[model samples]
Target: MSNMNVIVEKLLAIDGALAAAIVDSNSGMILGSGGSGVDLELAAAGNTEVVRAKTKTMKSLGLKDNIEDILITLGKQYHILRPIDKQDGLFIYAVLDKSKANLALARRKVLDAEQALVM
Candidate 1:
């Protein structure tokens, strides 16, 4: 396994990748970030709420599960938020250009990067 920096670097190499960050869902803090065309700080904070909300809703509904990932499709972009396994409260966030990115491939890349991430 590689460090968080290596994971972020690998994520940026994905086709049409715009930004990437490893965020602390518990505190909404960004541990590492890379790429451009987006404000990673803002994204980290906003997306933390997204993770919390979904988790909370699942608990309320009595569902025992984990969040594989959250994909938000915009008019021109794709945002993927994947919680890291074995690392509670940390997630990988990635943004891609909708027109230039292959959604399935990009999602898989994000999952791969998350899996390879070390502290």
Candidate 2:
């Protein structure tokens, strides 16, 4: 299993990756982060809310499903929030330059990193 730093490093190796972090959705805290461009700390906190809101909405609707990832596309960036399948209240947040990123490949890489993440 990979540690947090290792996971962040692997994420950075992906094309167009601008930043990456492991965040706790429960408290909106960042456990580990790497790379640059956007403010990872702020992003982690904000995205935590996004996760909470989505989960709440899902439960309200009684959707018997899980969120694989949340993708936010901006004019210049692509933000990915993937909840760790092995743990509760933790997630992987990755930001990428839209012009430089291959969304499919990036998503696949995130999934690969998620599976190997130790904590």
Candidate 3:
């Protein structure tokens, strides 16, 4: 696995990347982040709730699987929340420009970053 900066760098290299962060879900704080044009601090905190709520709903439904990632499509952007499998209570959040980004490739890159993240 790679360190947080390396992971964040890889994420930022993706097409149309606006921002990326390694967030601590337990506290809704950003551990490592890069890029700009978005308020990543606010996004980190808000997205923490999104992860928690989805997990809660999944358990309520009794699904025995884990979330690969959460994709929030907006009119102007794409928000990706991928839980890092190697670390508990942590996730990777990325924002991309929808018009210029390849959704399939962006999602793949996020997954790649998730798998490569270390703490």
**Alpha carbon lDDT of each predicted model:** 0.92, 0.95, 0.93
Steric collisions counted per model:
0, 0, 0
Better of 1 and 2 by TM-score: 2
Question: Candidate 3: where is the Cα deviation over 4 Å?
Answer: none
Judging by TM-score, tell me the better candidate of 1 and 3. Answer: 1
Better of 1 and 2 by lDDT: 2
Please, what are the lDDT tens digits per residue for candidate 1 over residues 1-119? 54989899989998999999999999999999999998899889999999999999999999999999999999999999999987999999999999989999998999899878776
- Cα deviation of 10 in candidate 3 (Å)? 0.4
Instruction: For model 2, state the Cα shift of residue 7 in Å.
Output: 0.3
* TM-score, one value per model: 0.96, 0.97, 0.96
Expressed as tens digits, the lDDT of each residue in 1-119 for candidate 2 is: 44999999999999999999999999999998999999898899999999999999999999999999999999999999999989999999999999999999999999999999995
Worst 10 residues of 2 by lDDT: 1-10
lDDT of 3 by residue, 1-119 (tens): 44989989999999999999999999999999999988999999999999999999999999999999999999999999999887989999999999999999999999988887665
Comparing 2 with 3 on TM-score, the higher-scoring candidate is 2
Best by TM-score: 2
